[model samples]
Target: MSTDNSEHMRTIDRWLAGEVVNNTIGIKVVGGPFDGRTKIVLLGEDGRPPAVIRASGGPAGPSRHAYEAVRSTDVRAGWIYTYTGPEPATES
Candidate 1:
């Protein structure tokens, strides 16, 4: 799995299927209505990108200029959506 933490990586015995993990670039989208949408996860207080993405050209937000510019290139940058699911029950 893609993790954003600097902690030493280690193998574990077991884990819950839906257990929240580190946040990072989970998925990359290319085409369709939602283009350049990357899944940046947020597991508790963990996870953060090393640097911000700088677009060589085009305006910010959903714009034809940005979309076309990104579509023309082999690949570019766009938006990032944080991933979150129903929080597991916590002990009170």
Candidate 2:
């Protein structure tokens, strides 16, 4: 498989594993913005509240916009689709 595919699989795995902890529970970046290149991050320990897990096109790039967007959305009622892949997912 391609690296992108691998990363995507990893993302899914992380999500299912509950390794990701974010205030934006329902808010998921549909297709990882930077393709499979997008990074997955987790904050806090097992039960603590998760902070920001920012993904970007370029490594070391800022995630202010993503943070704002996620915060703006209703994590309980709405979700945010990030444009980070070669092509965005159709079924998000």
**Index of the highest-lDDT prediction:** 2
Instruction: Quote model 1's TM-score.
Output: 0.19
The TM-scores of all predictions, comma-separated, are: 0.19, 0.24
lDDT of 2 by residue, 4-57 (tens): 999877766655443443521233444343333323333335432333444444
Q: Write the per-residue lDDT of candidate 1 for residues 1-92, one digit (tens) a residue.
A: 55733232421111112122443333333343344454333333433332223222223333222112121233222223222222334466
lDDT of 2: 0.40
* Residue-level lDDT for 65 in candidate 2: 26
Off by over 4 Å in 1: 1-24, 41-92
> Model 1: how large is the Cα RMSD against the reference?
16.2
Q: After superposition, how far is residue 28 of candidate 1 from its true place, in Å?
A: 1.3
